[model samples]
Target: MAGMAAKMILGNKLNSVKGELGNLAGGEGEGNDKDEEEAALIEEARQQQEEERKARHAKMEAEREVERQRIREKYGLKKKVAEEAGMPEPDDAGRITRKKKTPAEMQQALQQQEDEEEGFMDTVKGFVAPFAEKLGLDLFK
Candidate 1:
């Protein structure tokens, strides 16, 4: 009878230890869930960082394009802005008549040409007038 009681006590102790082991495994499962949550948070943060980097790169590219446009326009960098605008080319030094121009610019060019012609005429007149009285034939003739 004493051996039977001792056997029953040993069985009860084994059952209690098994129950404690099950509880420990349950707690470890919760820890694994927490680890998963932390990993997900880390992934989310990485994704946000990637998005921010892309946004910053796009912003910088836009700014660079604006700067390039400003520089292009600052000096007349275009070979022919009128041509690019689907109009005739601007002045070309090689051409006898020069390039076709807008009406406004044409007027300006004409005024400049007249001024140059007048200056040249004045110079010629001054050079010939001094010798006119010396000769019977007028140099202006």
Candidate 2:
């Protein structure tokens, strides 16, 4: 009796395996066609949603750009121009153009910056001198 039960279980398993192999070999009849149709429909729906998202994004970007231009105009701000040929064009004649600094002007600016830095360092040394003396660090020295 036990042997007969085991044989029955093995036969059922073998039959199921054969069925799976037949399906893998393209013998699934009408069910495979229905599955393929469903997959194609799903793919089509995904593509449509992607296209709609891209369109919506583009529309939002255009609206944002328009709003930015409106804000700039309200604030009397010039529209930013991209540099063409390594030079930016002025939006209007009334806009002030910056002149290149002469060698003398550049030298003066550098000297002024150095003096300011030295002054800052002197101020810091004055503030830290007492602490340095207490700790015997002699930082300035």
Candidate 3:
């Protein structure tokens, strides 16, 4: 009879442990669902804040541009066109994209610069040659 009672007590304890485990498992699923919902809401709020910040920045930039134009007009300063100034225009993101020079264009510019330098050197040589000749210096050699 004592053995029978011990077996019944053990069985009762096991059933209670299983019930607690089941409750814990179910509670964990609910907690995960709540966490996921909160995370989604936070992400959505962050995106909205980012959009608002961008809009505010754009508005301020526009106002600043208007003020700059007004000041330029007051001073009678003409805004040079990008092309005329040989400067690259700003792209949609407000970044200046440099114009890549073609190989032919680069060669031509280099040649023109060299020609100008050679002309100046020739004038200097003409001025110094007579002095060097008188001194027997032969500076060119």
Candidate 3, 1-141: lDDT as tens digits: 999999899999999999899888787789789999999999999999999999999999999989989999999987757555788554546547856676889999999999999999999999999999999998887
Task: State how far residue 91 of model 2 sits from its true place (Å).
Answer: 18
Encode model 2's per-residue lDDT on 35-124: one tens digit a residue.
Answer: 999999999999999999999999999999999999998999877665555666654657577665658899999999999999999999
lDDT scores in order:
0.85, 0.89, 0.89
Q: List candidate 1 stretches off by more than 4 Å.
A: 1-26, 78-141
Count clashing residue pairs per candidate.
0, 0, 0
Off by over 4 Å in 2: 1-27, 84-141
Question: How would you encode candidate 1's per-residue C-alpha lDDT over 51-120 as one tens digit per residue?
Answer: 9999999999999989888888998575435355778654466777745566889999999999999999
Candidates sorted by lDDT, best first: 3, 2, 1
Cα RMSD to the true fold for all candidates = 32.3, 15.3, 20.6
Q: How accurate locally is residue 47 in candidate 3, as Cα lDDT from 0 to 100?
A: 100
Selected candidate, larger lDDT, 1 vs 2: 2
**TM-score per model over all chains:** 0.37, 0.42, 0.42
Minimal lDDT window, size 10, model 2: 82-91
